[model samples]
Target chain A: MKLSKLAMVTVAAAMVGGTPALADLVFPSLSYRTGPYAAGGIPFADGYADYFTLLNERDGGINGVEARVLECETGYNTQKGVECYESTKGEGSLLYQPLSTGITYQLIPKATADGIPVHSMGYGRTSAANGKIFSHVFNYPGTYWDAASIIVNHILDENGGDVKGKKIALVYHNSAYGKEPIRTLEELAKKHGYELTLIPVDHPGQEQKSQWLQIRRERPDYVLMWGWGVMNQVAIKEAANIRFPMENFIGVWWSASENDVLPAGEGANGYKAVTFHGVGSDFPVFDDIKKHVVDTGKAAGAGDQIGTVLYNRGLYAAMLAAEAARTAQALHNTKDLTPAQMRDGMEALKIDAARLEELGLPGFGPEINVSCENHGGPGLGAIQQWNASDGTWTLINDFGPADRAVIDPLIMEDSLAFAKENNIPERCN
Target chain B: MSPDFLNFIETVLNGLMTGVMYSLVALGFVLIFKASGIFNFAQGVMALFAALTLVGLQTGQVPFAHLINAVLGTDVHHWGPGLPTVLAILVTMLVMIALAFLIEKVVLKHLVNQEPIILFMATIGLAYFLEGTGDLMWGADVKALDVGLPSGGSFWWEDVTRNWAPAGSDYFGMYIDTLDVSAAIIAVVLVVALTLFSQYTATGRALRAVADDHQAALSVGISLRSIWVIVWSIAGFVALVAGIMWGAKSGVQFSLSLIALKALPVLILGGFTSIPGAIVGGLIIGVGEKLAEAYVGPLVGGAVENWFAYMVALAFLLFRPQGLYGEKIIERI
Candidate 1:
């Protein structure tokens, strides 16, 4: 009993001293390394971990304040993610990136109230991109709504600048993340005089013969996929079997990955997807990773996988977390910072080409500047196509702004209406 | 007189195809139950495993040569130089037979006299084990299993005009998926093959006698252990066929086990011991629940289609306690 009491006292002492002694920013990573979604989740999580490790090792940490990442496996469940958030939120958490849309939705209110920021890059309630209703929630780069608009624009561009009377089918996973894009597509259909059909595939998405059989019967002009995990590969293969032109099919960012395409081989060729980030080993950031991290043996498992698509996404997320920390430290004028201070830092953070080059990524992508009223400022995305012969994804187009003259007012109006209904205060811009 | 009616009819037709797919899975559940008293809850996982194995073999994930070396102790990976689809299937059937033998010896043999429910729970454990094993062996990616089935459809006058019918007509014209139609035909063939083997073969007769009275069959010089092995082997084959149809339809993934769950309602609706009843029960439940969901789902929420099948079967149980074709029970005090 005396020993137990001593242990408890020691732990308490460690907690008190550890915060300032570490002198590093903490970003709690709620990962799902084991689940039905693990196949997709593992790569993303690995990338996230390695990038932070790289920063600490190669670049001497973010502004000399070492970045510390604590990974807690949540298995992609909302309840577990919430538990992870609560447990870790106390230990100087800079921000929370739940990855799961359901958990993101649940945390938005709590995080907003607590003054903690939630960075749901590319996957969350697309509506939460509305800075007025969802002040603390930041879904940057682009939302699902923006993705849908860009995809529609790409389709029309491919079909000679008209989509009137064309039929498009959305084969999506039956989840909040998958369904988020439907509102945008429905609105676009009404505006452009096209027909939209939605077909929802149940979770884990292994069985789609029936869904595709419906596709075969209906014979839509194009198919838009909003699937994740195993569903993406299945959809591609099914489309191939039914002789649907791969070029006519477009997948959201999550649906296009090496894991999704490699399993299908030749069958997945010519399948184009709207990608937000460029993928390949050509970037200078990847070169530094190979030399400083992988070669020096400081890298994690699969070090050879330095520049895969999901790996780069992970790097981007880590970069964002580190940048937020740097901003927080600078703003607060102290290395030892709180979650609230870190959130403010995130809002004030700006990542430009100079910062990217300093980190060894020469012009990796665009500069992002976050503000009070603008979460996803100047939303831009690229397009990539799968090349089965070379076994790689090739960039087909550079980042183009989503036809915002069409999407902006719609986003603003809907955001205002949502804020009024939910009793959320507008951002102090 | 509204587009809502047209949409409802279209949904019903879609539901019927879904029901047909569920019935194919149910057919496998019925097959095992007819021969053995144990309800095989792992049948859906068995289908998933089989389909994943097939895709794995074709994609060189599980090299044919490696399988041949493991089983037959021969280097035959390059043998026959890319076997035709038909030959690959035949080879897979042989592999399934070996797998059945292994399963009967390793798993079913240990729990021979356990209660049916206990055996059912064992199969559920087996289901989880197999799903994990299959995913680990074949890298948890979705693979399209195109078993050369046609996927085209045609619209008849009834199909075209059924949406124009009165609100309460309950008539949604048939628009069958060619895949479903083919699956139904294959299921019938499987049932007939199983029936002929059980009725005419000597081993089959011995198995049936064991099913009737275990002690009497033992006295009459029949081997219960061998009979159990044979029964399990047949069930495994049935699971493979079910897997091919299902895998071809959806893509082979671990989620195929949920499709196996649909068989429970089929078992409840049909007598657990009756083969014909299992098939008919599957069809009735499939068509009835799907029709209900299509016609009735929008009134509540859209997810009524998920639970409506089980609900209809539950209601049926209240009226007919022994199930639709269960044997009449005569209890003696």
Candidate 2:
């Protein structure tokens, strides 16, 4: 009987040991590397994956527990992205970066209910920057409204800070992502006394001749492009043909990329755009990539593309995800964490320059702090101009403070109304 | 009152230019409908694929040297100026021809004598298949198509005297986009050439003969198979030109297929079989919608342009069941 009891205990121990360890943290990467948006998606995915790999290699895991990133390709479709979220949410996913506005909209309600964080970064419902109703959704740096204000300000400054009686046309992609900035522009136009003409370009933005022809006839003083993929290049070429001063044109960040301008070559010279983050080889994280990721033979892109616009965006996104996990680990005694712990960790996280420097990203812009009331902590960015001759982008202005005074109250008022409508629970403050 | 009337006239004129572009695509539909009763839904995708291929060749994504070396067993590392453009166009044309041939051989050959509706559904399947294949081949980056077309306007309209006078007002003046005007001119030329060929040429006549009575034409010793190939080839060439013009205007992306859908209302407005009707219908829809959006759209809270073309076509359909130039039916059943 003693021998039998001992054998039974051994069997029970073996079964317990064989059972898979519950993952400390689960992060789902909603990637789109194979679809219409793949040109932008592929590099972003590569950078995201490399950063996670770097953390694993250098940190020996976040706080002694390894970090796991589960990737699901969504092909940039919202339905597919939501399906991926449902399939992976059960795995204790700490956060989701859908990288798509449509997907973010669909996931917002579910994410709030499930208490999982959704980090949209530069894209998604701009109104969700309100930390109240969209408590789960975080659009850090700035929202589309912030981007529009900056672009309009830059144009005003270029035209001597008086845009009254000027005609400004917006040739935008017809999607939620493109339409996000229109309301802000209209408000700004009303305040500033400028004429705003809205032209909606259907998806994939091929066939803009008629639109450009209208520009030629109407001769708007300034043209703001909210385009993506080939739409950017097409607009540039069309503007160039019509002899529209390239200097008078501004593109949203998504519309401004090396791929967009490089194809146009000399034609896209003097085009300007607003950037939420620093560009090119200026950031300190690039050095870390060279030493840790590239030197280790794990970097996923060509060596030259390490600090390109989209690549840096992907790097920044990964940094945010890793920092959230690190913050979570700091709170919990054990490094191994659950999604709830990560959520709590993200809410309390503070990422300043000193923190960035210590983390080997000294050149990364000012710190971002997340709280119950402010999901977009660093609502600041500078404008960059593309010089076709040098094949480079240069910072033209520092982050101007004028936009904030206008944007803050709007964010608060909108967030409050949204909270009321969505039945969002009041914050503890 | 004068300024208001001038603005009204300007908006109408602007709408006409828009209509011309819509007509170009619609004409492709009419051409295919004339030769084979099937509405080629893949026409828009064909335009996108052709344009992307042209741009890709110019940029040397997959070097022309490599393509030529692989094909001709040459060691050439560099090619001559504009050679890539020419070769890419040739290759695209050949691909389109092969596509037309394959479409006939694989799909249409099986559905011979089937209802027009069935053939239309098949073309829709072909549309999805072509879109996927085009994406696979070109990797879905929007590409700028440079078909050696000029895009700027001339100094004649910009002169001070021309600018000041009411008749010479920038609004009233013929300050046409050289590229769009070229596209319009090319479209007109193609339509004329097609019309003449159909009337004067033997093979064209044989194709028309086949269109008129397939069984009777077959009995008269004209091979339906050969005639089908000829008509599809002509349609394929016309599609290539349409693709080039539209692709140059917009970057060649998958969304070009939707522009092909704009041809549907054009087909409905113009009789499905009337070439002239397609042109007229396309022009009407294009110009009409833009004018509506510019003036009437503000009254309706904007976005009226999106549904205006369909509404106009629907209204026409309700009044004239046979279409503007469609054949009058004489039912035997």
Candidate 3:
């Protein structure tokens, strides 16, 4: 009942997964390129399509097989996302990047049943980091909780390692996506003895006058935002309107897109956000994409979006998926991979700094290894500051590691609760 | 005044300003519902389409950039130098008028005397069609609509109110977005214009006659088709002004349509058929939600603004279902 991905998902899903042999490695992009969230979706989808297109053009595809990328627009609606997943699961599907937490939640069960893998990536089911419970689902690099913990760690570092009396306000999106960090933030707030204010802005957060007014009244020491789409722009403007220190605000990665900042114009300067990968269009991997994909006029989206934050994240996600498919190919020693083979390949995945350097994505990621026991890799992150003078983002700090001590317990607790309720047996570590 | 009292006054002011925005959209709803007895669910989408058209025109962006590029294999995002804001608005108005005629000719004419629910459903379909058309024409990317309207908080207002802070208290001066103040003025002017148009003009009289009794008005030499077209055109104008204001405030995007949802509680509270009801209902909901969110919301962990309006409208319905200014429902069975 969430949304209709329509008749397309079934037809696509029917084609690839149910078959034994397929020429190309097929993956479905549960994209929302036309909605309130299209600003975020368009860039990510473009990056995704481009990076894979680069693979086909530059490297002749992953492991000598041209990757077949199909996109079904979800409008960020879960039903549509599920439709995309179900429809494309049959097209010799390797994996899914639902890109939405809600859709990932729905697909986790179905993907397990179908033996196809679901990669929620950075945005969904933080607890799916528990590979034992979510065998076919992967949320690697980091989870929202990992993100929340990194922000907290950064705050602790910012405060000269003491935050006993400071007040922190979390202005969040009021959905599952926004609520992801609340539990972890509360835990950190108690541990650090910092006062915490939780303010939830309803979706499409255009009107946040009252919320900013409250912040003005309370005057918290720091404010963290978990906003997306129009919410990010509105919140930034409101914060500036109320004279809230832009430097003090740290947004979730979703809030760190150019569309978010560009709408507010100069007011977006000095604002900061956490990112799992590097921001800016300066990555060398993008050169290969330009030379092979955009320059060749084969890019799936606007060539201008080649190096934006969300675009890079999309590129990064696609790279991971391609690598996973290659991993599966190498393990099975077969050019044609079944969904089960793809899952095994994804589980054995490893990407280090050297590998990243080899791939022209130096410093774009940290060492990442997914195992049967832990789907999430060493969840690494970095803080980036928006420099409006030049309209570019500068990474202000080296990539910080997500605090597993804080996140691991929550992941274990949630995944165990999920397993017990669903009668799922734990996988051997 | 104490800091607490100053904050309360400012919150109240914010609520009233927000009420003006809600009222603007609700006014469009009232005009159509009063004239045709059809609750136009497509009103919000109309506003969204209007805003997208304005931005598209303002930037000299080529319409159907995606489709044209796909079909012709040519990349052209803009045509030439952008139009003046005034010129773009004028062109957008003509487009809206054409849209009104198209809607009447294509959809509304066939359902001349249908049940209100069926008409409502038809408007919903119209909403979907217009929404898709808007995206297809404008491209789905978020567009910043800047016609050079002043935004951000009013420093003069803040400075003027600075003395109202209570002694030895944490008090920041009142903050208000200038756009909201302009919107308030525009809303008032719009109401005044509509009031005059409806009261004195010959076309206005015919419009009222149709609302009073469709068959009687038709018999008295007024063409129903013309009236329907005129009313829809007026609604389109209202939608255009609303679209410009909102698009200027927060870049033109898909979320522009959801503002129509806010107008609903205003409609229910003010009575669907009453023009003044749209304003009064918007104010009540706006002020009530703000107060509740500021005071009662904290008790419930905040975010009561989303539902408090509907709750108020629901309660109002129990006492007076016709709405605050709507005509009394009469039964003759």
Candidate 4:
């Protein structure tokens, strides 16, 4: 309590970026480089920063306008994140990538009021998929609901569509980020007739002997984890110790990273996690990144961390943001654009296979389309397995689309409520 | 053995091991409090700093890489090759001792005659300062500390125990990490060494004199300042051991500092000045919480590990406010 966390955040915010640019886009990266989650946060921050660096270094900046990359550390705390938003929102900041569900939920209202978009990207309020009511917030390319649906479907597919009396356990981090998939899982369980076991692990879940003991006792048929950071590593290690079938354990995209599984050693082999994009550094985009940024000695982080799974996800998020800016520039025919204009560009942004190829990232991720009604892009993801011996991941299943039947109505219901509460007109059409 | 009985035994064993880890941290607090009468809230952060320094030294990671890079416009990650494990540990010990001395001289010296609450608040500030300093020194990613400590399941123990267990019992013969076993052994050695050093050594007698009465110790020609420095250094050493155990267990990260909060309830149950009380209190809390999580946790949707220890401390305190082994206070004022 020496310095109020808000005060520290505000001071840290001013330290991020101060130079005003009239002909450039401003995107403040609300980053967490120091926290319990920093192990996961570092790569994402590095990748996000690196992508912007590459854009500026190689392409002479996005749409020929020098882009300003402001990195204000949030330490993964929600209130500090808001303080960061408050401190930096006035510096022509167009969008924010909070990378935390708690922060995203807190900023939804503020960003909506300020007319700047919040890009949560694959995480956050799943109902933010509805662009109409949540016009300023986007989790495009995927959402937590999409991940839940895809994971449940993958489980059903694995069990030959017959989990009539089977037990499925969700060992999730005990937070809004982890609890997000619960309702979706319950709905899927109702459909699949499977018994669901919810085991909540508190934040920074390092001690889980009792939870694992319970799992060993109950012997759930499948263990679906909604874990992040140290929790994922600990859970995987515990599961391996208890001799749980690693194949049957599926984690959300957050749980699938080298940092998460590598610590468990070979015991984590065959562990599976659903991901929305291709993993590894073998993609063509990495070559361009290496040639222009990393090899040119302009990389934002250690060269070794260039293309890890989380790193790639972060890079992809930055690309999407930059693409939105580019799209805005093309449509408006101007280099200087405001946050409002950027919002319009986000609404009309598209990144198809051709565009991915053009960006030197063919087959990197699924094609995504953003619109007024569908802020969440094509919600498709694949399952990847960990070859723990060799320390690499391989996609084990083809892309599976999220169940729109289950998710669309849920989004409609939640977003409509939000719109009503805020006295905003629905813009579904 | 019956499977239920075996499971109970396993839970107790696990709890005791966890309790030992907590006591390892609680011991540092006890040492400093007994000698200096300062409730050091930054003890956990001290452990974190020790571990970070250990890893940074081991890996030859340059201290203040980000700051150095920003200031000098150079992306320097390392100075050269890493040191051997033993050398790095020794260097880390030196760093911690120097830290203890520096803290005593700079921060602790200014507030010697202050009230315990004031000292406690000062320690909180120290905690924040040390935590921020640790992050700034080592850039905040969870670093793996490999002192060649054994990790993963101890299959030999499981294999041997499974031979005696009854057939068809789903008993996996108790899964315990080898790292935890190593830590428990190290902690036992550390406690024994501490006790012997205190009982049979000159510095130990001086520490005891300081603990007894500062003015009496000063009258007896024992430099209270030197004793304070010695005790803080010993506490720093204890924090290093605790840090290594935890950092190895769950990676060297920020949450390692939060483990101090867990040790707080232990200190409550153990009393501030009794080392033995720390051990006993930690075991009680660890066992109580684990068993509660196993039995009572399910009824309440689980996750009782968070508050069960504090609840135990609170319930224990209702009767004996001075704690189990605490010296009774005779107030005349």
Q: What is the C-alpha lDDT of each candidate?
A: 0.73, 0.75, 0.87, 0.86
Candidate 1: residue pairs that collide: A207-B250, A208-B250, A209-B249, A209-B250, B65-B77
Using alpha carbons, what is the TM-score of model 3? Answer: 0.95
TM-score, chain A only, candidate 1, equals 0.91
Q: TM-score for every candidate vs. truth?
A: 0.78, 0.86, 0.95, 0.92
Evaluate candidate 1 and give its CAPRI docking class based on DockQ. incorrect
Question: B175-264, model 4: which lDDT tens digit per residue?
Answer: 676777888899889889988998999989889889988899999899877787888889889999999988877677778887788788
In the range A1-429, model 2's lDDT, one tens digit per residue, is 999999999888978898544455566889986655766776677777777777777776666556677889898898999999999999878889998888998998999889888989878877677675676788887778888898998888877989999999998888878887887888899888999988776666654555665676688999998898767777887788667899899998888777677656677899888887777776666677778777766665434467667777787888888888888788886567776777677777788878878876674555688876677767776788999898888878886533776777777777778777877776645
Which regions in candidate 3 have their CA more than 4 angstroms from the true location?
A: A1-22
- TM-score, cand. 1 vs. native: 0.78
- In candidate 4, the residue pairs with backbone N, CA or C atoms under 3 Å apart (3 or more residues apart, or in different chains) clash, namely none
Q: Which runs in model 4 stand beyond 4 Å of their true positions?
A: A1-22, A295-297, A302-304, A419-424, B65-81, B156-172, B330-333
lDDT of 1 by residue, A1-429 (tens): 999999999889988886535466788888876555765676677778788878888777777667788888887889999999989888777788898888998898888888888999888777666676677888777878888888998888877988999999998888778888887888889888899988877666654545664576577999999998768866876787666788889999999887777645676789988877778778777777777776665665446456778777878888877877888888989877787787777677788878977866665656778776777755778788989999788878767778776677777887888788888777665
Q: Once model 4 is optimally superposed onto the true structure by TM-score, how far is the C-alpha of residue B227 displaced, in angstroms?
A: 1.6
Instruction: Kindly report, for each predicted structure in the order presented, the TM-score of its chain A compared with the true chain A.
Output: 0.91, 0.90, 0.94, 0.93
Error of 2 at A192 (Å): 4.5
Distance (Å) between predicted and true CA of B221, model 4?
A: 1.6
Scoring only the second chain, what is candidate 3's TM-score? Answer: 0.98
Q: Report the lDDT tens digits of candidate 2 across residue range B69-113.
A: 446755554344434677878877887788778888998889988
Give the least accurate 10-residue stretch of model 1 chain A, judged by summed lDDT. Answer: A297-306
